[model samples]
Each structure stands twice: as C-alpha cells, then as structure tokens.
Target: SSFETKEEQEEKMEKSEQAAAAFPPSFSVSEIKNKQRRHLMFMKFKQEKRKQKLQLKKKKKKEREALGDKAPPKEVPKTIENQRVYDETTVNPEDEEVAFDEGTDEFCSYFNGLTNPKVLITTSDRPRGRTVRFCEQLATVIPNAYVYYRRGLALKRVVPQCIARNFTYVMVVNEDRKVPNGLVLCHLPDGPTAHFKVSSVRLRKEMKRRGKEPTEHSPEVILNNFSTRLGHSIGRLFAALFPQDPQFVGRQVATFHNQRDFIFFRFHRYIFKNEKKVGIQELGPRFTLKLRSLQKGTFDSKFGEYEWVLKVSLSAVTVFFKMQEELCCLI
Candidate 1:
C-alpha cells in the first residue's frame, strides 16, 4: 500500500508538471524583485515581441505572394492631410464671385502686372545676430527687396511712409531673445495683412550641402496644396511677393508648400542633366510659418477685422456651437 501511494503521488506530480507546461506562468518584469532578473526578463519580452512581429510580417507576405494579382491593394497610412474633414471653404474654379473677389483683392495690382512688387524688409527694434542676418537673406531671396532699420518707429507711422514711397509690401520680422520668431506681411495702400509665427529658421551658414550664392535673377515661385479659399488667398499673397516673369536662365526656384496649416519655404536650384533626369541643389535659409491671423486691413491690431484667426484655445466640440452662433441671425 505504501509503494502504491508513492507511485500515485509521482503520477500526480507528473500531471501537474504537464499542466504547468501547457499554461506558462503569467507575469510581468516589474513583478520580479531581483533587478538583474527583471532586466533579463524585460529583454526576453522585447525579443519575443519582435519575433512575433517578424513572424506575422512573414505570414502576411506569404499570403500576399500566394494571392498574387488577386490580392487586395495595400492600405495607405492615414495622414492629417489625407484624412482632413470636408472643408466648406475649398475654392471652386467655376465660382464667379470668388474670381471677382480675387480680381479686386489688394494684391490684384501685382497680379495684373500694373504695379511691380517693392517689399520693404524691416525687423523689430534692436534686432541682433540671426534676426539681422535673416532679414538680409530674405532681401536676397526676394527681388527689389530693401532692408531698412526699424528705428523703433510705430508700424502705423511706417505704413504711411511706405505708401508714400510706393512700397507694395512691408514685411516686419519680430524677434525674441535674439531669435527670429514672428513675421508680419502687409500688402500696402488698401489692406490685407498676415501675421505668422515663424520657427525652425535655418540660415545659410547653418545649412549642410548648400549650393553657391543664389543668382540675382528672379526665381520661379511655386505654391503647392493651397486648395481652400483661405489657402488660395494666402497663396496669392506669397505669389505677389515675387515678379511675375521668372528668369529660366537662373534655374532658381522658391517653393511655398502648405500642409496641415503650416507653410514650409524652400529655395533650390535645378539643372537638367538629361531628358529624363534632373538634379536639384538646395539654397539655404529655410523656415516654417504657421498662420496666426489674417486681417482685412493693414497692421492695425486694435480696429482691423480678421478674415480668419487660428483658434488654439477652443476645443473641437466647441466648433459646432461657434458655427451655430455665426448662423444664428440666418436661422
């Protein structure tokens, strides 16, 4: 009877071992009291995860290969631009009212070739270091651009003087802690001013693999992804910065690319190496601009009417309530 009891105990122990093997211990590395053991377990867990991921990828590849041409198309990763909500303000080319508005806007004269662009570049009072260089470099990029000292004058006063001098555009670069941080672009005589928060300013000296000094020839301006009515207005504002006629001989290009409400400015020089192959080299002084507000008139912060102002403080749920208030009178 003792021998039989011992054999039964051994059989139970074997069954317990098999059951334990079937369902492995459930645990986390954090539960381990030993530091070294915890680290080792964590590394093993990471390796296991990676292994599983690789195996799954391999399985998917095999399935795709087996399906061949019949396989469903690969899913495209979602991005803010691709997944953006339907915008009611998108410009339609056939809209006559929009055409009329554009035809009579402040930058219309420049677009119509009736008046040449004369940009007066100035900085915030007492600009130092990079801010000064940024203005100088901006002047170099834009044709007929003149750099002027701010002299601690009020923008309202400077505006009238600029109008008297026949300057079409006034660009004021604002700096903080000796770093260029803001920009104000005002179209003259009539109105329509844009304020932008500037960031990621990469000057010529800071760039790597930059091309030689840009030529004096007027560069071709390219505005990309400006689809909405507001975007179209912003695009035109930048387009009016340069002369309409571009010098093909210069091979220089200035691109203002808008994506997810941020405007990225890039300068480059391109060369046609072959019929199909072309090479481009970057010319430096690149920066990013996020629009703060677009005003209907000149730089009057007090009385100017805003066409659009970026709402950062409001939550997404408040948008519907805000829209309802705007449509209250009509309702």
Candidate 2:
C-alpha cells in the first residue's frame, strides 16, 4: 500500500470535518451526568409521594379507630342483570297467588297434631354419590331420623311409604350435577311442605382434627337469634326439634341461625380436658337451608307461597285455642 501525500491527507481531513458538522454534536460526560441526576430526582419525588400517601392512610385509620368506627361496610356483590323473569305474576300468577285461608287451618292442625316429629331423610332416585353420602350424614345429625333411597319412586308413592313407616317428616335430598343442592321437607298425615336450598355442606371427617382428647360433656344448643325479643320463642321451638338422648354423653353443640329467611345449622361436639378447657370437633355436616317456599298441606302446588311459615305454624294453634277460650268466657 502506498502512503497518502500531505495535500491528499489535508483534503480528506476537511471532508471528514464537513461531514461531522452536518450532524449534531456527540453527547458529553456532563450531559450524561445531568440526565442521571434528573432521573434520580424524579425517582426521589415519586418515593416521597408514596411515603406521604402511606402516612395519610395511617392517620385516617387512627382517626377512624379513635372515633369508634371500626367496622367497614360489607360489600355485597352486584347481581347480574339478565333477561330472566322473576315476577311470579307475569310468569305464573296462579302459582304465586296465595288464598287467605289456604295455609291457615291446615298448617295449624298439622303442626298442632305433631306429638313426635321424626324425620326420614331420603335421596332422589338416581342420586349422585355425594348426595347419597350427604343424606346419610344428615340423618346422623337429626334425632329419630332414617335414611332411604327413592328407587325411582315418585313423591306420591314415597309419601305413603313414609306415612306407613311412621316418619312424621320426610326430607328429600334433591341432587343437581351429582351434588345435593335442594331439600324438600314435608310433614306427614297432611301438609305444609317446605322447599329449601341446601349448600356449603362440610362433613365432620373433613374437619381438621385437633390433638386434644375428645370431651364427654353433653352438647349445648346455641340459638344465635337471641338478640331480638322474639328470638327466645324461636330458639325454644328449634330446641324442641332435637332429641336429648343420654347415650351420647359427649357435649355436642348445635348452633341454629335464622338470618335473611335462611336457616343455617352447625353441629359440633366439644372435646374438653376439663370443664374449663374445651375445644370444638365438628359433628359431621354443616347445613345452610334457604327457605324457598311453603305449601299449605301435603305439598300442594297451588298453596306454595314464599312466606315465614315455621314460626307462624308453631304459634298458630296456641293463638287459636286462646281465642276460643276468650270467646267461650264472653258467651
């Protein structure tokens, strides 16, 4: 390779200088340092803002506590707006309309005559495995209860058999997609059938077992509707439904809840080292029964009304007898 002459080298340097001038100047170390400083300052500003926000939250929480406003409002899910007909008048008027005398006298007499109310828990014909097991567990919870399979027998057929078996109450477990989802409770010898939604069934065996030895104390019944004045009567009515057997000496606790037209029953047996120290062991199955409707007598479709019938039916006969006595004295 031949070396370039001085004049040629000078011309090349001039061309390079012209080309460099056409473009902007290259970044300097000072400019780079300035950019980094600006970035750090921005980050610091953001961090300070976040810290101030945290402090404000803490202050607000303290203020709320000092004001005695501890509990925040519960957030209920917004119901989906679908084109489903809920108005019974438009969909089925005859089914929704309840006659004034429909569930009155019959409901009164049926519950009034119930001296010994034994329940028969049966599953629907072709019930799923879970539903069959659920029915068995439910029978264990209720006193004087028996479990049976429907065997493709219709309600009409099953009712007579239930009556013949001397079962005062027939509880039919309805299954959906192989799970128990609904319960049909019927009174024997005539009417007032109630359909309830069954959900959240957790068996005792599924519960977390404790290390402590099981207690032998008799189970206590807790009725949580005790806040209201009329809660005592409701509690007593519920307590009467269960049998006080002496054979099972373990302290079994049954909590009954009547909230928003729904009945939730939680049964547990206490495992106690002594009377002062106790731990709970769930007695198989938790029941959440949502009241759907009550039929007047013998599961009549026409008399199916969405009403609080349990309390009313239990008190009806007493009210009727008192009225009759008052009339007799007046006469």
Candidate-wise lDDT, in order: 0.92, 0.64
- Residue clash pairs of candidate 1: none
* Alpha carbon lDDT at 77, candidate 1: 94
> How displaced is residue 265 in candidate 2, in Å?
2.4
Candidate 1 residue-wise lDDT, 1-331, digit = tens: 5667887999999999996564323866598899997887778777777988999989999999999999889989998778989898898867999889888888788878999999999999999989999999999899999999999999999999999999989999999999999999999988789999999999999999999999999999999989899999999999988999999999999999998889999999999999999999999789999999999988998999999999888777798889888899678
lDDT of 2 by residue, 226-323 (tens): 33323332343355445544335666676888765467887777667897988766665777877665665565555455434454354888899999
In candidate 2, which residue pairs get closer than 3 Å at backbone N, Cα or C atoms, i.e. clash? 191-297, 191-298, 204-284, 215-271, 217-250, 217-251, 218-251, 219-251, 219-252
Stretches off by above 4 angstroms in model 2 are: 1-114, 210-220, 226-240, 244-248, 273-276, 302-331
Q: What's the residue-level lDDT of 207 in candidate 2?
A: 59
CA RMSD of all predictions: 6.6, 18.5
Against the correct fold, how does model 1 do in TM-score? 0.81
